[model samples]
Target: MIKLLVVDDSPLMRRLLTEIFSAAGDFEVAVARTGAEALDLLTAFAPDVVTLDIHMPGMDGLACLDQIMLIRPCPVVMVSSLTAEGADETLEAMALGAVDFIAKPRGAVSLEIDALAPELVDKVRQAASARISRATRLRERVRARTGGAMARPVPRPRAAQRISVPRGPLPADGLVLVGCSTGGPPALDALLGRLAADFPWPIVVAQHMPASFTGPLARRLDRLCALGVSEVVKATPLHPGQVYIARGDADILITRRAGLLTAIAAPSDPELYWHPSVDRLVSSAMAQVAPESLVGVLMTGMGADGARAMTELRTRGGHTIAESVDTAVVWGMPGALVAADGASVVAPLDRIAGELMALFKA
Candidate 1:
């Protein structure tokens, strides 16, 4: 049986969560009414996974999460509200080592919790199997507390960083298409933070996230990395040294507009299981640009969203990089690509940037 600890101040939430997991079977469940109680159970219960609510009267979720990571690191899934404030806190929690987050129902009572049962169960199950690096989480917590002094310094932005280049002649530079889910945000930070300020290529990312979260995620990444990051809301011409994050709840596609390559937000396809579909993004880019001039990167995620398309990309002479199982939190997406013999290079998270740079140079 999978051991699970549900931490939330709301009695209703606790009961609902317990019922949801209990109904799923194979889950030995424990409940804590507060962070203090949760901490106590963290040792006594020794849960394989934790579902922590973000807000409580005292010793709130974030504070409790910090302690959990420092004391006994385990896979944690955050329960967050759908508001913007919730988005920020959830992102911070993910940075502090939470594996994934599920948004709370909008109403106060959240009587509609049954609607979230499947996703909650799946996320918890996935979290149970997720790999947690205690050293990395500790370092991240230290960096966060110390204003990032403990973190490696990213290069300062260049003088002429372009948010969106004018729609004119297309540049000769190729594009990097990145896809990730589950443990993506921190992995993205690690990958994008390593690139030099002058790295040549426009990177477009399709991270599975909700609409409220993606904007905040892009803003957070922009503050951390050298490259300017922005969510694709309109048809913006692609520019080297810029990173485009697909607006969540929708798909971002590459197309030509006025002879210039552009990133545009599109309605999510009903057929794709994951919104901001990676397959759609890569396939769309392939339609617009030569396969050899594109690069497909599939990172830590829970499914094979980009595997097939990236495999085709490799067959067509485009380069593909899969995050190796050693560094991937889940290894679903990248592992799929590797299994299909689609990856031109497979590397750990720390080595991905160097490999990408080498590929571009070659």
Candidate 2:
């Protein structure tokens, strides 16, 4: 059974969450009314996973999350509202080491909660299996405490050091296609921060998120990355040094507008399980551009959204990179690609940008 701790200030929310998880049969649930209570139970209860609400009374969810990471780094799933502010806070929580988040239903909490039960249970289950690196969390905490002076260098993975991809000059109009879910925000930050502003290819990302969250996510990435980042809300022409984040709740399709490569937001395909579907993105790009001119990257996400399409991309001479299990918070997406024999390179998150730079070298 999975041991889950549900932290929320609302008695209704706590009860609802407890009932939902308890009904799921495999979960042993515990509830806390405030952040302090949650922290108090952290050591004694020793949960495998935690579901945290952002609006707690005293210490608040973010503060509690910090304490949790510092005290005992276990997988955490944030329970967030479906508003703009909630999106920002949830993204911040993810950066601070949350495994995933479930957006709370809007209006009439009691009535809406039942509908959200399945998703909440599933995210919690996924979080229970997520990877949490205690050393990395502690290093981050130490660096923050010392303001970077006492920070220690992290050793690069041996696999990253020995990356041996064929050196070549990619086409002038080449594009990089990235797909991720679950623990994607931080991974994207790490990957995009490594690329220079003069990167040759325009990059597009299809991250599974809600419509309200992707805009804030794009804005956040724009501030952190050297590359210009924006959410594709319309038919935007692709340009080098720009990263286009697919609008959530919809799919971003690659097409040519008057001979210029463009990305347009389209209605979500009902057949696909995840919105901003990565499979659809790669498949659509392949229709307009040669597979060899595209590079597919499958990062830390749950499920096999991009595996088959990326495998086809590889068969037709394209390059594909999968985030290695050692670094991925959830090894589902990239692991799927690796399982299908689709990845041209399977590297840790820290080494992905280096591999991309190597592939695009002139």
Candidate 3:
């Protein structure tokens, strides 16, 4: 059975969460009424996963998350609300090492909490199975933060660096499409950091996130990467040396105008599971660009959103890549691609950027 710790300030919430986990029969639940208490229980409980509340009387979820990472380094799933503030905190929590989040339904009461039992249980299971290296690193960072230990120098902005333009004419239809969910933020951060600022192909990214969170994510990436990164604006022209992130509330479509590709932001299809859906992006790219000119990458996520389209891309001569299972936080998205024989390359997160560059070179 998976061992879970449910931390919240509300006694009712704690009890409800515990009952849900207990009912699943697959989890052994431990309860804490606050972050401080959760920290205290970390040693004795030794939980495989934790469900953390964002707001508590003292030492909120973020603070608790920091402590848990430093002290135990286990999988943490944040319990958040669905409001804009909650979305922002959820993204921040994920960046700091939470594997995922469960958005509390409106009106935080026992009934509402109980209503989400299945989802909460599922997320706990996923968290328990997630790769923990990132969490371990986060723990070390927390230690450094508290101890004033030496840390890596922050990367400087590239404002003064000369931007390299593509040497020759822009490749008629070449494009790089990246899709990710769950552990996407850090994965995107690592991959984008590895690429040169003057990378010569236009790259588009679709990451499952709330609309309120995508802008912040783009800004964060812009600060961490050499390349300019921005949330997609409708009808914006796609250009090399910049990365475009799909707006989380809409699907970003690649459109050709006089042979130049541009992004068109459209309302998300109600039928789709994810806004800014990876499948929608890939399908649109395939329609606009030659198969040989496209490169599709499916990364860590919880579902098979991009697998079928990735397969089609591969069949038509586009290169396809998937994150390797051991390196993925969830492995479901990339695993689906693998199971469908969709990936031309299966690589670890650290190697994906280099692999893409090599493919572009060849």
Candidate 4:
């Protein structure tokens, strides 16, 4: 059985969570109403995973997360609401080492809450298999950035010098396609931040995120990276020096027209689990462009969504890169791609930026 610690201040939430896990038949849950209580149970419970609530009385979820990571360091799935504030806090929690999260239904304990049971159970199972990133790096960075204070909000991403792409023909260098999930946000922030303002090829990213968060993530990336970032709009013409984020609620397709690529955001196939499915994106790119003119990158994520497509791209002479296990927060996605002979190169997190640059130069 997967040992789980459920940390929520609301009694109703705690009960609902326990009932949900109990019905799942594989989880042994121990509930905590506060962060302090959760810490006390850590030694006795020895949970394989934890579901933490963001709003608790004393020592709120973030503070509790910091402490838990400092001490035990296990996979933690954050329980969050669907509001903007909830999304922001959830992103911050992920940066601080939480593995994943599930949005809570509106009512505390109603029919709506019951509807979320399956999703909660599914996410908990995913969390169980997730690899927790090293928190010390993030902790130290936070300390340095905040002058050793731990109470401040996550710092806003620095604004980048925006570059306006001219209305003209696409560059001859080709296109870059990136696919990621789970721990993708920070990884992308780091990878894209390393590019120069004149990055010659158009870049498209398929990141598994909610609709509300995608816009904020794109804006944040635009502020931090040299490339101008925008959420994909249907029929929008793509250009060099710009990074397009696939719409979170839809699958985005790249189409070739007049020597330029245009992004078409349309309703995703309901059967697919991941919105903006990476496989769909890569498959579309392969259809529109010569395989040799593609560069496919598979980063940290939970599943093999893009592995097959990436392999196909590589077989057709496209350059493919996978993030190495040592640096990926979760090695499943990239590892699957690498194992399938999809990647032309495997690089660590810090080196991916340089590797991509070198590939572009070549």
Q: Is candidate 2 or candidate 4 better by lDDT?
A: 2
Residue 263 local lDDT, model 4 = 85
Of candidates 2 and 1, the better by lDDT: 2
- Top-down TM-score ranking: 2, 1, 4, 3
Candidate 4 wrongly placed segments (more than 4 Å): 107-109, 133-171, 257-259
lDDT (10s digit) by residue, model 2, range 211-234: 999999999889777899999999
TM-score of each: 0.93, 0.95, 0.85, 0.86
lDDT of each: 0.88, 0.89, 0.81, 0.80
Maximum-TM-score candidate: 2
What TM-score should be assigned to candidate 1?
0.93
Question: C-alpha displacement of 113 in model 1, angstroms?
Answer: 1.4
lDDT of 1 at 235: 97
Q: Write the per-residue lDDT of candidate 1 for residues 263-307, one digit (tens) a residue.
A: 999999999999799999999999998987898999999989999
- Higher-ranked by lDDT: 1 or 3: 1
Summed backbone clashes in each candidate are 0, 0, 0, 0
